[model samples]
Target: GREAEGDIQKGQKEKEEKEKGREDQEAAAGASLGEEAPCSRGALLSPSRKAWNPGPAESKLELHPLLNRWALWFFKNDHSRTWQDNLQLVTKFDTVEDFWAMYSNIQLASKLSSGCDYALFKDGIEPMWEDSRNKRGGRWLVSLAKQQRHSELDHLWLETLLCLIGESFEEHSREVCGAVINIRTKRDKIAVWTREAENQEGVLHIGRVYKERLGLSTKTVIGYQAHADTASKSSSLAKNKFVV
Candidate 1:
């Protein structure tokens, strides 16, 4: 017991020493004779007793701000349960760092099981067709073959996300609602949904920008379909209102 207590004390001392070293570095970075440098409260307090507080230069990581906060949803298919029951909210993130952190931790789009789906929508909006913000919207669909998943799914998904966060659609960016990636047995689908399907200029612009960003071949045809049509269709087919 005494040895264990001694070990604990040694660990605490080492921790305190490391902390003091960090504070000293911060102080050296923050100290400037004629200039005010930014320092955290802890850094400032740590070296108050020292005659010379030389804080280490602040190594602040500049985080890029996204145009909007996005929520990521995951749907794991369960034949015994309703579709709504299978859909679950994974997480919501607003900053660039948080987005990447979440993205890196999750299973890659290509690796997900068939019948699963990943949806990223602006905060406060659900990814379902019935959501008020999405009811009037339509998605620019990019259907990828099963083979493409191994080669292109993850890259395409990242591009779609960048388009959303970067506001790459120009003036039409405001019309953008979110994006979705559906993992299916036959084909994997990636779609960027916008708020108004009827906004021809915005919809087409979003589609062109999206398709170009994904580097889709000219021979590859992508379609845009209204949610209304998608919702009412009995078959898995919906009429394409526009194509690019």
Candidate 2:
């Protein structure tokens, strides 16, 4: 769940670039930029269609495929509409080249207006807590200071996305559902949502891999918060169930 934002002024919630910017976030100990992300994996193999062809020669380009299909969702905090109504599906991709095409084309996280969000979830799962796959799960939350929004937000967000499509968690990847980035007026946040909160070994392993993949420096810590706890709270902040 999220804090009540209906009272937030409309002017403040306007998107940075309606056709460009929007995504979501939080802070953590430290992390890498994941420059070497293997974005090869995506979802189902697309059916051959002339509409997908770029041109005569390049049309035959073999795209690197991902292990799973993923969907990108966008949310605009609108006081007039229900939260569910504001969420929209942007697109779906399952190939490395396609993912990059989409990524490069979209607005960077830092450019999004306040209250806008971007969620990259496995094809079948929604990025909200009510989904069956996420109901009992929790997220590895990373909170970012306001200043870091301009400096680290884009790099960290890209790394987090790479970690997802690249399947960085090894055996624990199956337990992962999706990730969300919230661009708020105050502190920004990025969270990786998993299917189970009680899977200690798996959850902790994911946290470690995430931190390592992001190339986080030692000393700082990131926390994990269950969806149930977050949903029931009246505030955006939730108690940490685990930390790494």
Candidate 3:
């Protein structure tokens, strides 16, 4: 409850400041302040904090630091509303504890109805083809048969989210954009999107790490497809550029 309250407070403060900054920039010839202020970045990004402690009560909880802040989004399909309108921001967190709190409180991916999607992306990056961060990226897709939806969907989705937030890929982790779980009628799909399609080495490394983390069988095959291809061709017919 405390963690959830802290997240709500943080989100509200950030939203208000963003709105105010936008208005101020519009009045000041359209040059907006960057997302991370200089002083804040210096404090947040510094390596010195690794050794700092906030004393006893805080020390009781082991703080797991993440490489980046991530935003969780939910898309509830509605025939009466546009796609963008149905997509809503749930919350954002940069720590392992907060992530677990949010994940445990929300409905599992398996419980979501067909046409719904859960996307976890880097903060400030929207989970869509239109977002500049995702425009050039591609996804490593794991398609599940309809029969597997009830049994494996939720587990796989949670594993994927943990892999991303935990920086499990080591050096190649920086190339990861986010992961998505799309609930569909015929099949449910889980994909991990990376920022560059052309970086074959990094892409493959990420894929290997992802597959290993999920404990996927050697018989199972997953494909990687560039966003450019998915954007032009229908998703159902999109060709795979790489497979492992």
Candidate 4:
């Protein structure tokens, strides 16, 4: 029994070390981007990395409210279920603290099974292109190689979500509809869906700001595709209306 306990403890220590290493890597990436990570407050770490125990039950903690209330939706690709049935509304939050709390409690994007997706959008907006707000719009799509899912996917996804809730696009934020992360076996994608594809100024501005916020290299191009086009064809075959 004592020997078994020793092995279990050693395994726990190794797991802790791996978690710490992941956190360090994310921090370094954020530093290179000239910004602090959205999870820097230890919000994104695995449960083993830190004990996230709350204080007194009646404790009053001040919450920083966001300009918009956002809804989080999860889609698990289950052939047994209808498309709508597979999509579930996880929760909605309007405060920064609440967002962090929700994020800390959920499984990280990178950990989601292939074909799953996580979407964050303004409270009333559904994630589908069929939504009235999204019908006439387009998306700024960033495709990631399968190799990047392990090292870069989670960080990029969180940054995208923060950009949405943080209003990182300044005045163009009004054009923002939401962001989606699609997990795939071959390659993954993240897209910021906006309300008007015809509003070139707003769309381009969002694209520029989003790319920079993701710390993507200037040479690494991202494309904006209209919902109309994407609806008619596979994403791979859809032509980009704008690139940044």
Candidate 2 on 35-143: residue-level lDDT in tens?
Answer: 2211122221111110122222222334566778999999999999999999999999987657766786788989999999999999999888899999999999888
Model 2 weakest lDDT span, ten residues long: 18-27
Q: What is the C-alpha lDDT profile of model 4 across 176-210, one tens digit per residue?
A: 99999999999999999999999999999999988
- lDDT by candidate, in order shown: 0.74, 0.74, 0.75, 0.78
Model 3's alpha-carbon lDDT is 0.75
Q: lDDT tens string, model 1, 1-244?
A: 1111111122444444444455565555353322232222222212122223323222232333465788999999999999889989999987554665576678999999998999999999999888999999999998888899999898899878767865677778889999999999998999999999999999999899888988889888899999999989931589999999
Q: Model 1 misses residue 29 by how many Å? A: 24
Give the C-alpha lDDT of model 1: 0.74
Pairing residues by index, what is the TM-score of model 4?
0.78
Please provide, for model 3 over 1-244, each residue's C-alpha lDDT reduced to its tens digit, 9 standing for 90 to 100.
1121122223445455545455444444233234532122223223222223222322343355566899999999998999999999999998655665577578888888899999999998899977888888899999999999888887788778877876677778889899989999998999999999999999999998889878899888888999999999877799988888
> After superposition on all CA atoms, what RMSD does each candidate show versus the true structure?
14.5, 14.8, 13.9, 12.3
Candidate 2: where is the Cα deviation over 4 Å? 1-59, 234-237
Q: Give the TM-score of candidate 1.
A: 0.74
Best by TM-score: 4
- TM-score between model 2 and native: 0.76
Estimate the TM-score of every prediction.
0.74, 0.76, 0.75, 0.78
At residue 122, give the lDDT of candidate 4.
100
Give residue 139's error in model 4 in angstroms.
0.2
Which residue window of length 10 is worst by lDDT in model 4?
1-10
